[model samples]
Target: MNRRTYLYAISFAIFAGRFVHGAEPSSIRVLVWDEQQREQRQAYGDQFLGEAIASHLASLPGIVVKTATLTSPDHGLSDATLDATDVVVWWFVERVVSRVQQGRLALVTLHSAHWSKPFVRLMQERAKSDALQQIPEAERATARIEYLNDQPYGKVPKADAPLAPALTRTATGWSLVLPGCIFPAYRPDGALGHLTTLLVDHPIAKDLPKQWDIPQTEMYNEPFHVPTPDAVVFEERWDKGEHFRSGCVWKVGKGTVFYFRPGHETYPVFKQREPLRVIENAARWLGGEVRKNAP
Candidate 1:
């Protein structure tokens, strides 16, 4: 592990130690939201993609799982629903961005959610964090950041667009920061990926092979434009020369945010055992729930 990875592990262990000793553990309430887009049928037959995931999570002990979709009235979210959820595993983004910002719940954003509103907002917040350190308190509120792609707010450039460069400040009274959201390009046709574990000791990496194959999955070329990750537990490479930091974790406000890149709507990526295990591990880790009972 690199210095950053080691530090992240130590910090997480310290945080988890508190809850490990003090009180009785509570069941984690998980909300799995799928867009239920028709394209997903190419991978999941009869079952909505999200429903398949919900089924797996429900089978696990100490988890209360609920599946929701875009078709639900109020889009499957409400004050009550949000109140009951402790961790949200989502394929698309819309209603939950505010709740994440409030630190009301943690987030586990799947594949395409890289472009989702909450993910974009998190990237922007990371940009602001980097930008603030370079300026005085006198200029923070008045400062305007120039996003590299020049896309309007809430808009991401096309997949073919160039990756934004490093964040810098301009002499013209502005901050020029790369949105750090998109990669340089993508290959949606699917590639065979070789995934390698980078942080073996992390709870998210538990029981996963040191290296594994994703027989076929979409490819995302990197340098992923987000801020430096708190921990990168996995890296994936394609035979076609594409690479991505496949599993990344970040501390967002009082809650945490995790991004896992594997699933593609047209593929049965999530149906694979390893990917499912990672999701199960992430949900428990983020929700502060136990993965195994203490003997």
Candidate 2:
């Protein structure tokens, strides 16, 4: 071949290799892990809760989804599995968020996941962040964390009871305190919950109603003891007037963490159209899979 033609052929081959190897379209990978506790049958019926969620995500374009259970080998969280997943729907436990802190993936923490280790660690970091800003640098080393809630888990305080609020300042530095995760009370007989959009402009709230009702769900009163969220997108309220900040988000490291508070394994909350939409929307937003111009 002529010299120019030989050069052109080499360049074309190089370009083809780059296109084939480096330009593969990336698909968002989702792992839904449910404890698959029998209680979930009350709401999910035959399908496990995690399976139900995974089934919904699989239907979306460009999403590659899988479901794992506590029964799975390595509890469904082997290094290989987590390394391949982009977003995790956790129904129990906490180690996954450490991966999130490292910017490997974003986390969508669900209801009652408030007690999850990742959520607690995030709040602790947030509390320390808040306290550090308020105190002098000289006191940084001696800052103390005092546990405020002395009671056992699931103990609900009276509505009028005093809450051990967050970020209490002290003479040396500051006191990092948080109230109990559970409210003072809950009515298991069930009540109709009204969810009001608190931040309508947020991507997670896209296509949602101004207000929607959960026909029958248990109640959780407020004073939800976590660090102040970066945004509260939805607030849930019961007919009796008890209320909770049901949807909260925080930016952690290079990704975001979202806590959605509607599911109660025994309740069919996830089966509802709106709640399912919320989960799907949240997954897309957190995974950076949403297209800028797509409606």
Candidate 3:
């Protein structure tokens, strides 16, 4: 671990000690939201992928886990669920974004969830935030912001297309191109993916190896059409030379969002130690940080 990683780990330890000693809530409330697609059954057997993850988290100390799926009432995102949650893992729903932005909950999106509504909307919100920073401080209040629509879903971006989350000066103010939230290309042939920790010191990369490989996983090539991430914790490359920023994090409004790109419904990616560790670390760190700052 690098210096940053070391410091963050120490800080987390201190906070964790506090939690155990009664400084705050003893357990982090986690909600695992899975779409529960039939394809997931191939790798997960009887339980859906989300349930598998929730089960693991529930077994860990300092975390209370709940499983929710699309078939559940209110799509399993009832107000009670959100109110009790500190972090939401996997999948997405429209209502969760406001809770995230308000610092009431953090989000961890996995794999194909890159296109999920909450992730897309948060990226757009970040794009707008980035656009405003370019304006003169004095003019920001009066500057008009216009957001362009995202690229069509499943539409692969041309290599030469202007990257999304781009901004241009407009006659009135700024024209912002929302993040495509998609990538240029992908191959789902269950190729081996070599992953390297790019930000070893980041809290999300805590206790993770500097280099690892996914025995069988899909590949997504860059340029991922999203705003520059606040931090990229891990990067992945395939034997064919395609690469992607596999783990990215951003701060939108008062909360944090992390995207982990490794799961494929047909692959047992989440069953691996590293991916699960990443999610566990994110859940604990995000939940702890939010509570430490909560009023």
Per-prediction TM-score: 0.79, 0.79, 0.87
Q: What would the per-residue lDDT of candidate 2 be over residues 1-295, giving only the tens digit for each residue?
A: 1222111100000000011122224545566766666777877889867777778778878656666665788866665655444444332235444545555456677776655545555555555566576666776677665655433244556867665445676565456555454456557665789999989989999999999998877777787776678999999998778999999887655446777877666777777889888887787676562222112
Ranking by TM-score: 3, 2, 1
lDDT of each: 0.65, 0.62, 0.73
TM-score of 2: 0.79
Model 3 spans with C-alpha error above 4 angstroms: 1-24, 87-94, 150-154
User: Could you tell me the lDDT of residue 281 within candidate 3?
Assistant: 93
**By descending lDDT, how would the candidates be arranged?**
3, 1, 2
Comparison by TM-score, 2 against 3, better one: 3
- In candidate 1, how many Å is residue 124 off? 0.6
Residue 187 in candidate 2 has what lDDT? 72
Looking at model 2, residue 66 earns an lDDT score of: 66
Model 1 over residues 32-109: C-alpha lDDT tens digits? Answer: 776676777888888767777888878888767666665676555654545444434332244344444445556677
Mark the regions of model 1 whose C-alpha exceeds 4 Å error after superposition.
Answer: 1-25, 87-98, 136-165, 178-180, 289-295
* Alpha-carbon lDDT of model 2: 0.62
